[model samples]
Target: MNIQHFAAFRAVMMTGTVSGAAEILGRSQPAVSRLLDRLEAELGLALFERRKGLITPTPQAHRLLDEVERAYVSLDSLKNLASRLAKGQGNQVSVAVLPALGLSFMPRVIAKFRQDWPETKVSLNVRMSPTVEEWVAGQQVDFGFAEMPVRRSGFETEIFSNAPYVAAVPSGHELADRSCLMPEDLREGPLISWTPFVAARHLLDQVLVTSGVRIEALCETSLSGAAFEMVKQGLGIAIVDPYTAVLQADERIRLIPFRPAIPFNLALLRPEFRGSPPTVDHMLSFARDLRDDVLARVPT
Candidate 1:
């Protein structure tokens, strides 16, 4: 019997459906079904009896699944070990970072990572918080760089910094004269917001709700850079992450500190307690170095 065939059978039996198995294995439904068919053909055992859109595990299937499951888990552990041995100190890192931070924060970290591990090739994925969380939780990425209060399951997290909120206003706007603005100051004028689902948007809503600021949102955009650009054009005022807005250095738009602090936690994460490949470990170590060096002097 083929090992992979057994593995597929185990996944299908455990998940109770081909679609669920496909999700875990990151394959298409038809592909997973084909694998299951191939497995049954090779083993000469009908592992599951399908009825009424549900998979019924046979007694024999249940008995065989236990051994197959253990074998696959052991193989996974051995694969991790062998991969680490094969690399023996390599400089390739695959990482996922939230789009908000990826724009400004990752460059400094990447530069430091490159300097320390000259051969290290760092690949950065810019995704939303949910996507980053899911990728790390799924063990699809070696590491994830993102704002904390995230929804990642089976992961370890370490906070690096508190990313503060800043008020972005046109250089000559009335509120621009003030060194800082209150949540109320935001509502008085047309307001710009990020996409409603982003962490910043949630934080903004929380701040507004707590402060009793029923600020009207003139527009919502996905990018802070774009929001700040609109503010610079005097179209409206925006509150955005200091990291992304600070990078713009748009003299036309000033970054003013805000009261009733709005902050997000930045963290480094890895899947919970799973042994990392040597390349993964080296990259993680270097990423922390890069994070510390860059975050320390961000001036936020």
Candidate 2:
């Protein structure tokens, strides 16, 4: 009922012994037992049963422990946040991104952000799209970047950028001579592609099928950057977002537009309960400027 009562209850339930709880609470064993007894009397429920100097939690105690731990964890987080603010290091932002964006696009944005706000700290996590969506919905990060149209509630989504998928060919490969590629052009070669579960893969499959083009698949990968690497190694021609193609471009690989353009889209997401930090808005503006410039010259 009171802070002391809750603390005693938690300490005793957690440590499973009156002496251990007493040590944790900086009290004598008798004092700890008295606190527990008072709490039980106040609530008119037995929180623990004791026999032979061992303490065992009652059913109600087990049910209450989870809520108690959660409250303490939140309090601990608040304490840490206060400490950070005291040290003048609270200007921090966290973002969750999918592998495709993390590979190169986000690194560029981070660098630009640091250039402008040198004192601000940025944390980035590269995870699957579902995880990114979940983090955004849960307010775990300032925002998240992921594939478009995340259907989860409790988040607002906006278009980040869009570009067409392009073909990646190894230097001196037969397709390198072509300025643009068609599905039929890739039919004779082994295709390096994303895993089947990827949205891009669904689009690619539809295009190939509708064009009556089929090819042997050399490999399927989760990361577009990995597909680009395979292309550089002459594994096969790969279809990837223009951002990745531009990032991985070199004399060893050529990026060309594929016919019937498959759009690569992304979204900026924010939780409904949290307002975007000014820094986040600024970063969003900076990223859009960079995206416009980069996408304009994406080699096709």
Candidate 3:
């Protein structure tokens, strides 16, 4: 299929009419319409229906649109690559981060990266822990920061920081005044928690096994923040990463380092099959700088 025809078809779909697409693409309406026609002929499917001079999307068009938009995103990424290479800015970075890091670390990294490589174009893709590893190993993304362990086949992983896990407890709880807590501390209480699929849970489970301690997950949830709220409301104590511990606004909960120091280590997952892109490499360095800056001020 013709890429130009696809682009034209996409433009028409986005702009709602041939004339509107012409305006956006700076082409004549007839030219846009012809390209769209060529695309439809090739696909043997009508993309739109002409109703009272207005082009309305067909069932097939709507069905195909989501996939087409993803194609456009990839195409746009490639276009930016070409433009950056041609201009020789010597700097551009694209980094994908997990949902947890998006709250705090990613923003600081982006700011510092821009300062060092002012000409760089930074694109941030915030994803879940599972996706972050896949993106790096698959080479679909340049870099990723996640709260999970690195398990992908073609990626190099390192422990940037051993993010100690903490138990968030209500202010009136016996352990709230303490700086650290053990698994046995909440053996009698309900556990507000994260998914069992997560690394944090894995580590906690390991610790529980050796301690012969298993607290009932009376109220479990997928979101760390939401689980924290459950504890703040005196429902249960949750084992959460330090990142979320600091961001939550509820004054009723205290963040105490978990005993046995179940480490929620952070890593930079990079593609193993290919050398990193120049921009992506720069972003990796930027991320390291961001990590160092954060560590300097945080309590040991």
Instruction: Point out where model 2 deviates above 4 Å.
Output: 1-82
In candidate 3, which residue ranges exceed 4 Å CA deviation? 1-73, 83-90, 229-235, 246-252, 273-286, 289-300
- Model 2 lDDT on a 0 to 1 scale: 0.84
Q: Which digits, one per residue and each the tens of the lDDT, describe model 2 over residues 1-300? A: 587988998998878788888999999998988998898899899888888888789999988887777567547556766888999888877788998788788889899999888998787889878878877886777888888657687789888877888999887887788989999988756788788888889898899899988766879998898998888888888998877887667789888889999988888888888887788987877778878877887976
Better of 1 and 3 by TM-score: 3
- Taking all chains together, each candidate's TM-score versus the true structure is 0.64, 0.73, 0.65
- Pairs that clash in candidate 1: none
lDDT values, one for every candidate: 0.74, 0.84, 0.74
The residue-by-residue lDDT of candidate 1 on 263-286, one tens digit each, is 857777777766676767665665
The runs of at least 3 residues in candidate 1 whose Cα sits more than 4 Å from the true structure, single-residue gaps closed, are 1-90, 276-300
Question: What lDDT does model 1 reach?
Answer: 0.74
TM-score of 3: 0.65
Better of 1 and 2 by TM-score: 2
Residue 190 shift from truth in candidate 2, angstroms = 1.8
Q: If both were scored by lDDT, which would come out higher, candidate 1 or candidate 2?
A: 2
**What would the per-residue lDDT of candidate 3 be over residues 1-300, giving only the tens digit for each residue?**
788887787888887888888998899998988897888899999988988878888989987776677677667777888888898864556677776667666777677767767776777888777777766775666767766456566787766777676778888987778767788887746777677766677777889889998776878776676777788789988987666666554679877767788776877777677666666666667767766655443323
Query: Which window of ten consecutive residues has the lowest lDDT sum in model 3?
Result: 291-300
